[model samples]
Target: ECISSVSLSSLIAEEFDDFPDAELILKPISDGGDGFLDVCRFHFSGKILNYQISTPYDNSELICPVLYNIDSKTIYIESADLLGLKVVSAEFRNPLKLSSKGLGELLLKIENDVSSGKININKIIVGIGGTATIDMGIGACSALGLKLFDVNDKEILAIPENFNKVEDIEWDNKTFPFRIDLIIDVDNPLLGRTGAATVFGQQKGASESDIVILENGFNNIRNFLQNKDITDSSNPTFGAGGGIPSLLYLLLNAKIRRAKDFILNDLGIGRLKGKVDFVITGEGAFDHQSLMGKGAGIILQEFEKRSSKIFLLCGIIRNEVNKKLPDNIFPIEINSFFQNKDESILNIESGIRLACIKIKNNL
Candidate 1:
């Protein structure tokens, strides 16, 4: 079993100390964003190339890379750099005025690097979560030259405090060298109760008043884009970083589908049916979000269809996955395993190995 992040690593140490004879071995699991790109290199015969882009918080610049598999005609980008909250401190974690410009820059860089490959950017599943900035998609559009200007025709750079005053939007992206498939993790609407403003705004540090401003902001941008014939599943950046999905749909013609479906179908998870005794997966949390549409939930559903045993391990699991959950699905939260923060996060490798070990032993 493999884990990711420091917390999982520490947990494994504790496990080793507790049960010296445990048969399982734990390694780290990282997406392309961190060390996983290197793991990818070690496991597969792909070349890792580097490019510089500002970190998500805009505090400094760093060189991150996209992995290319010449034989597969595919490129891999680790969005954790931009999406992960590690770059932002608690103060800046406030989504109000948080910018996703780094993400846009990263995407543009990938597009530039793939010039010689001649293969279209078919699949782009951004590991979305832990984002600090929530300019909806404004920061990203600005980085890509999709200008949103005020009535005076002066450039409106920062995310407007509220959407009520958005005057106009301009975009001329008729041609791009490649196509993109965006894998998203949520189903938040563009406005109102279930939308980004109502649900995620507060956690992002928006007050009640700020929520009003953000709601209006998202609506204004949604209107602006609609006028220009750029719209998406929700017509704005609703989910993943405040309307990032809608922005991708309009500007990039990307689809905002569940990440699990994309990964499973493309990776041929069905082909692996009955190949393994049990399956385990998870995310930051297991909640209503997982049941509606999540990579983990979808994977479990797929396994259910195949009559395979499925287990979920999460940092935290909601009392209910959904109002009506299937009988076969089982969720285990390893948070109960640790007595303190240091212990919980000690062996933390994103909790995958621990989750896996628990699942294995239980089965």
Candidate 2:
């Protein structure tokens, strides 16, 4: 699923080839992560609005896609398109310097377009995940007209590196004119050991010292919010997208929902519960973390509730963490056939097809 769109498509094609007479239903899912927009595009009829936006590094440009659904008057935006770690080079990846400003710019452009009658969007659903920054939404808030000032009454950029310098933050509610819904996969809070920077900063290329700074930055922002009477910083979805949902919840009154639940409800999965034979769900990797509120894990839970057999096809299976898989669940790992991660990903289609063939012949 991470390598190419062909992985899922190839899986479906092979599944149909294996069971020509059986009815096959493909429900591609994402945990509001990297592939979220693709899932939305496949299921929803929408027009894509492309705009030149800043990359996470703040030095380059990316043509970000926003899906505007005509039927629901909703606009779908994926944060990864703007601030994804993949957008930045591995050598230069640094959470301290990266910003979510591109996200803000996209939102502002959407709002302006709506205000000018260019689009009739009333709802904004932002898929927040797979981001590169740990600024706690400061870069995004700045783009939405939130001003941060230092002790000397000088304006400052709200990046993680400058977190300790921010003395005050200000914003105008009238700037944003749409109902915001944040789609999140994880339920970690905004503060503490399991919080944004502490849990995810290292993956975004933050060093040990950088993580300490990032933690302090998040704490500073938390303290600032506390002084403003926004004391509830322990919300479950706050840690998602580098605590972007937390800021959106505090400032924009955004509603939070698990991406799997939201997508399942939207796809009317409840109606298909008993009609389906078996459910096949997966992601790039399967591990203990996936069970902790991730989309694939949630899908597995749903299928289990319906008493359906489940097959998990993943690139890698962390046996140490995923040792307690359910009795009715079967896990297929493609790592055994390849020598390395890159090779495994490049040959994912063949690996999955082979796995399907074995399963079909065995059954």
Best by TM-score: 2
RMSD of each: 5.1, 1.9
Per residue, candidate 2 scores C-alpha lDDT tens digits across 1-363 of 445432485566666674765566766766687877877877786999898888877667889988889889999887888888767789668888888888788888888899899999789988888988787787887878888889998998778888877788777774467898888888788877898888998888888898898888788877887898877887877889988887778877888988776767875655677778777777678888888778778877778757557777788889885678877777878777778888887887777777677556544
Name the regions of candidate 1 deviating beyond 4 angstroms: 1-45, 57-59, 114-125, 231-238, 305-308, 321-330, 340-342, 347-362
For all candidates, the clash counts are 23, 0
Could you tell me every candidate's TM-score relative to the true structure? 0.77, 0.94
lDDT of each: 0.60, 0.79
RMSD of 2: 1.9
lDDT tens digits, residue span 31-118, model 1: 2223334433433446766767776555487776667676665555555555445666677665666777777787777776557654
